[model samples]
Target: MGGNEQKFIKEAFDTNWVAPMGTNVDLFEMDLKTYLSNNVHVTALSSGTAAIHLGLILLGIKAGDEVICQSLTFTATANPILYLKAIPVFIDSEIETWNLCPIALEEAIIDRIKLGNKPKAIITVHLYGNPYKIEEIRAVADKYQIPILEDAAEALGSSYKGQKCGVFGDLCVLSFNGNKIITTSGGGALVSHSQNIKSRAIFLATQSKDKAIHYEHSEVGYNYRLSNISASIGRGQMEKLDEFVNLRRKMQNFYKQLFENVKGVSVFEVPNEDYFSNHWLSVITINPSETNGIDCDDLRLALESENIESRFLWKPLHMQPLHKDFPYYGGNIAESLFAKGLCLPSGSNTTEEEKARIQNVIKCLFKNKIKKKIKVKSLFPKRQRLFEDNMLVNFFTKNRLETS
Candidate 1:
């Protein structure tokens, strides 16, 4: 926790504003609004999942309605669709950004249109804080006239073409969970361009009560408002958001540099300067050929044996047991990503010693077979089948590794 979080929490206690509705919550919302200043209104809630559920409702999703969602994102993105009893049509990711693929998205829409039931909304996530092909995806959504619910839960500070990820969709969600870039202990918020929508969200979140003096009958409501204590933590986290983003970016650059000599492993990065990611969790994709058959799972096991936490990328929703029968688009991009991607430890407080240790472990793995392959290739000369037929040479040749 940042040092000021306790101070804000103490203020809440000193003012005797311990309930959900208090100055802390109000300030927290305002701070979020100021931070995301695209004239967007923010409504802090209990969790990112709650924000998504509310966003789906606001988008008019209902029973049997269909929602298009990125298949390679966390379950929270698709669970909200299920909450409304809506069918989630999962679309696979592209290799470029590892987000939603535009071609597959359009194909899904065309197929759904053929069935005479277009999706009511689309939920595209900036997975691991990397922006998707926003311009292309937005064009497809516009062509279909489907509103987008941007799940910026992992991309608070990410941007595409100078526009913030959270401001790209009709309705967007932000998470301040304990494990996110910023923390509110456990909280989230919804951002929309319309004040009316924000007001409606607040009303629904606060139990959809009428403005009557006494409790009155009303529509179904949820107990999803952020508490004073959690909001206080959010307020403090917001104060250090820029610092947090900078630290994360620094860590990402460090990883990129460390992996420069590690064959078969390339740090996942933004495609170009037009995309700016928060680098929320530094990730890498291991090409088995380059790493001498060491895959992401192997690295994960190695890290786990050393008591270091590393994880494989999110499994596509289309592959989940519950979503096995859902409509899907795209080929093996999502599946390959799941098989080869690894998320490294990128906590804000990770130390230099920890990073060096991680680098040493990877170096040791490379020494096992990587050195032998290079030696055999050097002895055989270029264009001669070295250790074995592998994709690394093809990839390197295609990318012009001499210049890289």
Candidate 2:
């Protein structure tokens, strides 16, 4: 944690304004507006998920409605639909960006419309701080007259075509969870172009109360307002937001440089110059054939053996048992990505010694795989080795795995 975080919290206490609304919350909201400038109004909330739920409600989503959601993202992006009793029609990701597939999204829209259930909104995500196909997805949403609620939970500093991601959606959400680009400890904000929408969101977030001297509740409300204490942390985080984004990018570049010559791995990259991501988590796909049958799981195990924390990418939500019956479009792009992809440690505070250890483990894993394949090929032609290796035939059977 940065030193200034305590300063803001102190201010909150000093001023005796420690409720959900206070000086800190106002400062936090202003900071967001200044950073995300695009005629956007910001409302600090309890969580990014709460922001999405409220955004959908402001967009007229009600019980039993349908919202098309990207199937490859975290469940937080889709769970809010259930909060409103809205059926989340999942959409698949394209191979290029591992984001919402425009074609599949369009097909889903057409079919749903045919069934007389035109989706109330399209919930797209910029996964892992990578910008999705904004133009393509926006085109489909516009064509179908479906508003978009961009889940920029992992993409606070990411942009597409020079426009910040959160501003592209009719209503966008930003997360300040502990691990996010910025930490409010745990908080989020809703951004929108319309002031009315922002006002409505803030009103609903603080509990929908009628403007009366007495306690009068006109509509159902939620306690989704960001606490003053949390907003204090957000205000401090905003001070170093750009630094955090730059650090994240540097980490991604470091990974890209380290893997540039490696045969088995291709670090995930920005699709083009039009996209500028925070590179929240530097990830790569390990091709088994290129790496002598070494896969993502193998690398993960190696890292674990060293007590280093590396993880596989998220399994697409569509394939999850909870949403198993949900209709999903697109081929196996998301599934294939999940199988081969792994997210390396991309924390801003990662040390050089830690990096060296991580890289050494990966390098050794690949080198061993290459050498074993070569020895097997020499022992019994490529075809014979392929069959024999499956049966645990050692490259140096006589030498034996048990050495003196």
Q: Pick the candidate with the highest lDDT.
A: 1
Model 1 vs. true fold: TM? 0.90
TM-score of each: 0.90, 0.91
Name model 2 segments beyond 4 Å from true. Answer: 370-404
Task: Write one digit per residue (lDDT tens) for candidate 2, span 1-404.
Answer: 65699999999999898899998998899899888889799999999989998989989999989999998888899888888888889887888788999999999999998999989999988989999999899899999899999899999989888777799899999999988988998889999997888889888998898899998998999999999999998888888888999999999998888888888799998788999999988999977788767667556656776778887677678777778777777777777777678899999888889989988877776765553211111222222232223222454335222111
Taking every candidate in turn, the Cα RMSD to the unseen true structure, in Å, is 8.1, 6.5
Question: Candidate 1, after superposition: displacement of residue 73 in Å?
Answer: 0.5
Cα lDDT tens digits for candidate 1, 97-211: 9999999999999999999989999999999999999999999999989999999999998888877778899999999999999998888999999999999999888888888
Residue clash pairs of candidate 2: none
Q: Where's the lowest-lDDT run of ten residues in candidate 2? A: 372-381
